[model samples]
Target: MTISATIDGQLVQWRDSKRYLWLMGAIIPLIPMAMWGLYALTGSTLSWYFGPFFVYVLIPTFDLLAGLDPNNPPEELIEAIEEDRYYRWVTYAFLPLQLVGLIWGAYLLGGGTLPGIEDPLTVVQKIGLATGLGMVAGIGINTAHELGHKKEHMERWFARVALAQTFYGHFYIEHNRGHHVRVATPEDPASSRLGETLWEFLPRTVSGSFKSAWGLEKKRLNRLGKGPVTLKNDLFNAWSFSVVLWGGLMIAFGWEILPYLVIQAVLGIFLLESVNYLEHYGMKRQRLESGRYERVSPAHSWNSNNIGTNVLLYHLQRHSDHHANPTRRYQALRDFKEAPVLPTGYAGMMVLTWIPQVWRKVMDKKVLDHYDGDVSLANVHPRTAHKYGASLEGAAA
Candidate 1:
């Protein structure tokens, strides 16, 4: 049976392994909401705490708190890129939750309907909420990362909306065509240099991706002979959309409430950028004779396969295979023997990235191994000889 078939438990006339992954990836957003829903339904303070703590503390800790070790037992599933149906599905399921969260957040900001808790979860509840928002921030971008790569207009549009919610929409463009292509080299601003710290990477990634989105879109627009993407383009629209959307919320609620939104979005983007800082930390693409970077190989990006996070996150942590084959679904993306493996999952790696020196100290050796120092324009976008092209027959190019 095909990988996606195993996940969806059904066949497809024109499907690969992505059905389950896409289906699952869309579900991550609903988790916190489900928790919130239970709290709402139960009308209990403890219930409120349950949702946040699990999302914030428990789920994120699978990799970080555990120190990212997954004891080997079952290699029962090794998903690949094309089977991202699960990944995409989770994302789809999660979106309505985002809207609900936004509405709830707006309500809280507006002082409309935030029910008073009975004090059972006063402290833990707060921590859970914070962590929940943090996860929202983190997962928001990760979703954008996945959606941004799709060729569908709806996918790209949803990705933009998600990014805008987090105030990091530029990632949609810069990541898909820019960073993933030029990563590990000086050309890509998102990828941290060998000696760079995570702190230094933050502003650069934030600003660079934003501006590069314009450039990337411009390339596409120019290719199609379109006008400037100032207002009509989704990239720029994210900025305007958020301004009005949040502004309306502030007017409805209070300006003070805006801080929560900003903080959460900032934290979320940081969560993602920190991960970007980790992936390809010391790796660079090889130059080929045609003046392009070599094929998207396992060596180009880092990989991690903590079972819990891998399954929960829709295998995003196994990035090497995803980058190696951009169109591959997340479910089918797997750990390749040749690719480098991180010691922990994304959450753990993210925590590790906070301490720049410590992160460098830990990952220094791994980075050095894949450093391709002598790259030039003579070697960019290297020809990929692998058979990834055959998989693009159905959904998109």
Candidate 2:
């Protein structure tokens, strides 16, 4: 069924199919619920691990089989799509479910009265459950990323609330203030360098991001003549909330729950870093003689038009457009023909990164090709410059 309406002096037809596309993101939350249901029915540990298995295994296979989505909405319909509240509501409605799944996973692993796992969860089961649930919580970060860019106050606050679930509240500050400004440069910890494996990138990103968040907050306070210790620091406010929430969970559940929360939060942060690593790996904005990098363009990021993951991640695969226009709504983000394209959706790419040799083999040539074999244009890792014959002396710092 299709509904037609007039807007901006143009006739807009909304088909039922197009109307419900945002519901695709609900798959992230549903995976955990399905895993728990299966575990309850069969009393199998395999069921508890099924969520991550489905995400990393089956989803990528299906995406490969389904192929890409080359279609884009007509230019006239973009305004209507951006204005549609259905897409935003789909994200908001899932926020509470993310928390519920986190709590559910905690209860099961923390030796609560959950029926699905009667025996005390083993160390391996706890880790497996935490990792599985962490991926689900990553959806909250994705939603937060979308909402944090909005101009509305409530949406921004809700984004922080979602971030607190994974104890990743500082992402709200660092990403917008630090990452966006320094993206595709050596100054941005979130942007992965060429030949940097996940192992090397994770430590730098995890530690550098928190430090960057603090520095960004301090700079903001200094500009306003407010001290660093004041409440005006959004990082302080957000992380304080996370600390209190984690403390409260410990009290409500048990000491055992502390490790569960910590482990899951680590996984959630890793999930974020993994996406960050892929978004601009080995891509750099050119530095003009004026001593400033050129404006970020579509060519600075990797884009994937894989239909399955695009819907699953709320069009994050069209990253080139998102970075180029930070305020553009997800539904309105466009794919650029000039942007470097990923060979597959993020899911498959993430799995490949687990084997560093495979990841380097596949991505190194692509990165070199993007710069037309000029290694200097790529963001070469400082230690690995010898491998690429790239000089960092004139590179944008």
Candidate 3:
């Protein structure tokens, strides 16, 4: 669709080239169904691992081939594109498909046989299927993230529904109120420090974010003269959705599917945290003389314009703009030229995070360059501060 507006006595028109491509995100939840079809046709267990293969291998390859898309809508057309109902409907479509896929996957995990298969799946194959489900759960969090940032009540409710799959409802609270406030600082657990491996970051972020979310909710309840344990607490209310969803599935599918549910949920959490580890790795906001950190700017976050990941993740790669304008619709997110650039799209970068040495080799230099070769200006890991000539005093200042 071409968005046209008359601004300051001049006619301006902008057509979003990737308008239809955004629909690809909604198709992600259908990967499990596609995997089942492939297995039915080929009778190969390898088809169960299709989710990880698609995300890690195929998406990265597509990113390399598709390259960057640096185009931003003209300034006057930003409001027109953001208000388009078509774009939001595409995101809303994902929730129903995601729920259906989870139910179907649970049935299969519980030994239910379908038209094509006469025999039940093996344990190994079941684990592969669980891993595939994990991919959907992980990406669903990204979908939730987009919806959660909006001011609409319906969209916020949809965000909680998306998070129910991973039982990560706390993220809706912490990300919006906690992380955004403390991002790129020592206090934010979601912000990864220099020399901190993905192995190190995963546990810290998972545990810390949970604690932070709980604290934030508790404080809000205290103001209302309520206790944190009540349903009125955002943490408890958000988590209630997961309890109903998972508990209902267990009743329908039997207790045997419990282990696989745990597996998928863990992997889903890991996948989301991996993205957090890379988004602001080594970036820091300097403290001022008044003992306050500077306001977040485009320089604080890493960004990419890779068309493949951009289409798949709803322009989430434009992290700088997201931080700058939290409520801006994904279609209206503009890339800032001043932001630090990633070597490739998020999918490719996530693979690098798995190998600590390789990740440091590829990214440490980029961090140093971003800070003009000053280690003190970066968020260096406390254990590795000396290695980077960064003192604790300098970091705190």
Candidate 4:
């Protein structure tokens, strides 16, 4: 579908026009963390569940904003997605609050093994904290994820600090330099191989992500010929600092804290991988005779139009365009017609993903038979648009 370029005497993209959306994208994570802080005073069960759900299901969804495209958006009710996205940039305002929540949570929890395991109150507290810590991770880890890919260096630094919360220090290197370049292809270790279930996708994504991050650092070091020390090597520094800080924090707080911290890391990464799973699913690229892949297009990634997911995550559901133009920012990424479309948005799919058999059945055929393009570089690609209810695919070209 072609779009009208001229509006108000300017070629404004609908996605770019909605810069205000970005403001919502930026700081929503703090809402739950703040609630968790208030809950800290009460230690109520409702607070525990609400905190984890908001962090895991809520904040990460803010990422959808990063994938908005102005060419096609959710009808005229929302105009100028790009302008709306400019607002999302404001999310950094809550960064300090997120930090406070994490430190406070760490203070309340941390340490090797908990003593007095027989105490009911302590057991409940431990479980609650386990989930709450994951929520804490959602704040730091996911928040950094949104900023890490930006062209701005200060934004990238903010992302690094967020990664430090989960002790996943190498995300800046692995994600920007590694994942973006290799996504939707076998070259990207983060992309799930054919027939690989999400269960299997988990280990490969986590381990591969860390390894890639380290390798990124090594490549830089080799150019400079410096050891894996010095502040320049952020990953190494983060790893060392994380181990010491987490351990020291645990010792200082009490044994109850360590399990929760580790759990948070696992949960946050798991959420990250889940997004990875949805981003590529069955999409792939074309390999040219030169032994390099063809230029990326929006058709190379999967798209989901589910309004709930789109509204929540800031349009990250439109992933294909983001990968095609990594620096375009969420505002400029177009919601192209070539990408494959998902039946549901992220929230529903996230629920479906939990049941492997169902998720496989639901997604496999849609990916296999529906869309087609130059996939020798990697396999299936689909398109999704929020404005249309229809799910369409282009048979292999």
Candidate 5:
């Protein structure tokens, strides 16, 4: 059932499910809320694990059931979809749920009342509870990523607030200024190199990103004649918000609550990083004779059009369009035929990336295929290029 109309003088079409898209947004909050409710009613420690379970377990199963959606909206409607306030408001309305979920989960674990939860929960129980809350915090990063890219003033600030829930506020400065500029090149810390395992990439990215963010911020402040000591420094201000958040949790809950908050926030941060690793795993920009890399294009980042996960992620899997045009709102981002693609959505891929052998087995062939078997066209990490053996000569270049 498709219908067509004119909006602001542009043709618009409503597809089978697009008209009811707002309802899909509830999946973000409802799944975790339901899991928490189950834990409260039954007092089963195992119930606390359901949040991550639902994501890593159930979502991937559903992905198999729902299959891919290759139908992109008509090009003419891109502008109309962007102009529609419905999509923007859906992203905005999600902000409160993130804040409430964070606070509510903290209360559940911090000896606050619930039917079956005991005062002073076991350390094991606390960890389980934190794991669930961490999934919510990870989704907060997704929320921040969607909003932070917008040019609007208030939406940008709200992006920072959403990121602060996971103590990842610096993502605003680094992702926009640093990663976007250096992505797919050897210089970008966020992009995983050939043969690098998630374990190896994690520490490097986690530490390097902070360093990159600070350096980027410092340069900006320097241009304005400000220093780290000044409140005008954006990095300092963003991190200050995170510090205040951590301190607030300790005050509102207890000193004991601090550890759970820290663990949960780290889990959220790791989840975002894991996604980064897969997005550009073995790809790189070609360096030109003039000593500059070729301009970023759709080929640089991996794309996934898995319908169910794309909806859940607000179409973040459309990475090719995003890197090529950072300002394009998520709804307007399109999948390109030339873009490299993942075998599955992010949830399933996240699990695969943890096992280095399986990840390489699945993705290495795709990397070679994307560049027509020429390792020179790919970003082969110097240490592992020899294994691809035939292309080693050119790959070293």
Candidate 6:
């Protein structure tokens, strides 16, 4: 669809080339069903692990093959594209499918058999299926992210529903009110530091974000003369959704599925944290005269334009625009030329994060270059400050 707007007495027309491709994100939740179908056909355990293979392998390969998509809608047409209800509907569709997938996965994990299989799955296969479900749970968090940023009440609630699968409901509170406010600063737990491996970042972000979310909610509720434990506390309320969902699933599927549930939830949390680790790795906003960090800008975030990951992740690879305009719909996000570009899409970069040496080799120079070789300007991890000729005081400053 071509959208036109008049700017300075000139007609400007823009068409979103990836309009339909956005549907790929909604299709992610159906991977478990695909897993079942593949298993039914092939009877191979490999089919059960397809979700991880698809996300970690096929998506990265696709990113390399698909290359970049530098298209940006005309400034005049951003609102037009944002208001197009079709885009939001696509995101809404993901929630139902995600719920269905989780329920179906639970049934399978509980030894329930479907039409295609006369025999129950093996323990190894169940573990593979759990990992696959973890992929959906993690990606569902991304879907929740897009919804959580919206102003609509329903969308915010939908965000909580999506998060229930991963037991990460508190992210809705922390990401919007906590991380966004302090991003690229030492205080922002979600922002990764230079020389911090993914192994090191995982526990920090997970635990820190939970604490930060609770604190934010407690402060908010205190103003209303309410305790943090109340349902009115956003953190408490959000977490309740996870408790209720998981509890209900356990009741329905029996207690034996508990271990698999934990496995998927933990893996999902790891996946989300891995993305957080990469988003602002080694980037820091400077302090102002008043001892406050400078406002976040395009420079504070790493960005990618790889079409495959962009489509799969709902343009989340355009992190610069997302931080700059938090409420902007995914379809309307614009790429900034000034933003630091990653070597490839997020999927490929996530793979690099597993090998800290390889990650540092690939990204440390990029950080240095982004700061014009000023080591002190980067968010250098205090322990590795000497490696970069930066004092611990300067790195922590």
Please identify model 3 stretches exceeding 4 Å from their true place. none
RMSD of 6: 1.1
Please identify which of the two predictions, 1 or 5, would achieve the higher lDDT against the true structure: 5
True-vs-predicted CA distance for residue 61, candidate 3, Å = 0.5
Worst 10 residues of 1 by lDDT: 388-397
lDDT of each: 0.61, 0.82, 0.92, 0.61, 0.80, 0.92
- Write the residue-wise lDDT of candidate 1 on 1-397 in tens digits: 3432243564423233334433544455555465567777886646544533554456567555434422221123433333435446666666667666765655544445444433333444434454556567577777677777777788877777676667776676678778777776657877765556788778877888877888888877777778755566757776765777677777776775666677667767777887788777645565579988666677767778665566556668778767776765555565677787887776667667778778867776565444433222111222211112212221011
Model 5 pairs in collision:
none
Q: Which ten residues in a row have the lowest lDDT in candidate 2?
A: 13-22
lDDT of 5 by residue, 287-364 (tens): 899999899999999888887677777888999888987877777778899898898898899999879999999999
Error of 1 at 42 (Å): 15
TM-score against truth, every candidate: 0.72, 0.93, 0.98, 0.75, 0.93, 0.98
Per-candidate RMSD, Å: 9.6, 2.2, 1.1, 8.1, 2.5, 1.1
Which regions in candidate 6 have their CA more than 4 angstroms from the true location?
none
Question: RMSD in Å for candidate 2, one decimal?
Answer: 2.2
**How much lDDT does candidate 5 score?**
0.80
Give each model's clash number. Answer: 61, 0, 0, 52, 0, 0
**Per-residue lDDT tens digits of candidate 4, residues 69-127?**
33454433233433444344454654666566666656545432223222233445556
lDDT of 2 by residue, 59-106 (tens): 788779878875666666777767778778987877777777776776
